[model samples]
Target: MTFTTRFAPSPTGPLHLGHAYSALLAYDMARAANGVFHLRIDDIDQSRARPEWEAQIFDDLSWLGLSWPSPVLRQSDRVPRYRDALKTLWDQGLLYPCSCSRADIRAAASAPQEGAPLHGPDGLVYPGTCRPASPPSGPMPDAVMRLDMARALARLTHPLCFHETGAGPDGTTGEIHPLDMLQTVGDVVLARRDMGASYHLSVVIDDADQAITHVIRGRDLFDATQIHVLLQRLLNQPTPAYHHHRLIRDDTGKRLAKRDDARAIATYRAEGCTQADIRMKIGL
Candidate 1:
């Protein structure tokens, strides 16, 4: 199949060095393979996503000489699509409403499970606190909806796996597998009852809709890939190959963020940093 990849950045702040590295890396791979590179704005968090930041993203990517094949896909405009996916998962009995507050989950997780560490992605492995309270019929509650991760794991007939192209111990693409969802990363939120949709659901739906074949981003998200893989299986959607590149960090060794405007792409450019300088600074 023709390779297709994307660089999806949240427009909560200006594009920083780390953002540039990820976008450039994905663009390079797409170009090298004669594939398609798509740009997507993960602006689902409407509360923080600003139009100015979104506009700046387009300017910065163009400045770096990167180009995508089509118009960018903004998550904010794709709520209906995400909602549809949630409805499907709920219909299949793969999801349940979680009303436990943030503190409640922490309290339940205070007691550890034997050799299980008592915690996972969604905080405290849920303890099934709300499981007993789940409604018997009709639509799920307005509270956050979480997929039955433990249930998802048991349904896998064989150990699930995905190939990661252009990334491995030796900087080469390799296939990794047998992702044990429950043991490592616990139940992740699929769609927060109040947030409209969770990162996991929005991302998978957008990628599939954009026909992204390879997902190239940061290593920080490598673990999260397991959750995405499981969701793909549950939804019977095609799984894309992944390439999680190393992250660009500041002298303090912390991963860059939008708040680090001192290292923002536009800032660097204003300071007379050339395209090659950026390439060197980010090790692209």
Candidate 2:
């Protein structure tokens, strides 16, 4: 199959060295395979997204010697597609409205009856406070939507798995089984109360929409791939081969964040660092 990959970044902050490593790696892989490379702006969090940041992303990627086709996809402009996908799952009895806030979920998970709180890729796993016994009578306004993990898994005829060419957080590689998704990824939010769609939902839909064949990204998302694999099965979409590469970190060994402006590509450029300097810094 023709290889395809994307470097999707949220425009909430500057592109740090970590971002540079991921974008350059994906670009290099796609070019090496003579396949397509895409730039997707995951600007779904409209409250925090800034035009200047988005512009900086283009500038930084261009300065790093990367290119993608015009009319790059932005999550904000694709709400309708996400809603349609949610409706598909809702109609199939896989989704329900969730009214629990973060605090609410935490409290519920810590309750004596609930036992120790289970953590997942997205943090403390939801405690299923709003999961319904059956589909609601009609639409639920001002409520987040969550997938019924058990219900969704039951609809699958075959075991779900995805190929992994890169290491996971625990050095896991090869085919991955989504066994922990049910317990650890419990009823993950599909659509947020504020935003129409969550990362898990939007990403799955976006990959299928773009016909992405190879998902090359950081190891941080390796565990989340189980949730993605399950969503792909529920949505009847094709699963792509995954390569979760090592993350770039600071001297303290902590993974870089967008807030690390000192490590920002723009900062490095202003200090007279070239693209080669970036590659060497990130050990590419």
Candidate whose TM-score is highest: 2
lDDT of each: 0.79, 0.89
* Candidate with best lDDT: 2
TM-score of every prediction relative to native:
0.90, 0.97
Model 2 ranges off by over 4 Å = 140-142, 174-179
C-alpha RMSD values across all candidates: 2.8, 1.3
Candidate 2: minimum summed lDDT over ten consecutive residues — where? 173-182
lDDT of 2 at 179: 57
lDDT by residue (tens digit), candidate 2, 31-92: 99999999999999899999999999999999999999989999999988999999889888
Provide the lowest-lDDT 10-residue window in model 1. Answer: 169-178
| lDDT comparing candidate 2 with the true structure | 0.89
Mark the regions of model 1 whose C-alpha exceeds 4 Å error after superposition.
Answer: 112-124, 133-136, 166-180
The clash count for each model shown is 2, 0
lDDT of 1 by residue, 1-284 (tens): 88899989998899999998999888888889989999989988988899999899999999999887666788888888888888887777768877888788777766565334455444456666665344235875566887776666667786677888655435644333434455556666888755589998998998888888999988777767777877887878889989888888889889888899999999999999888999998887
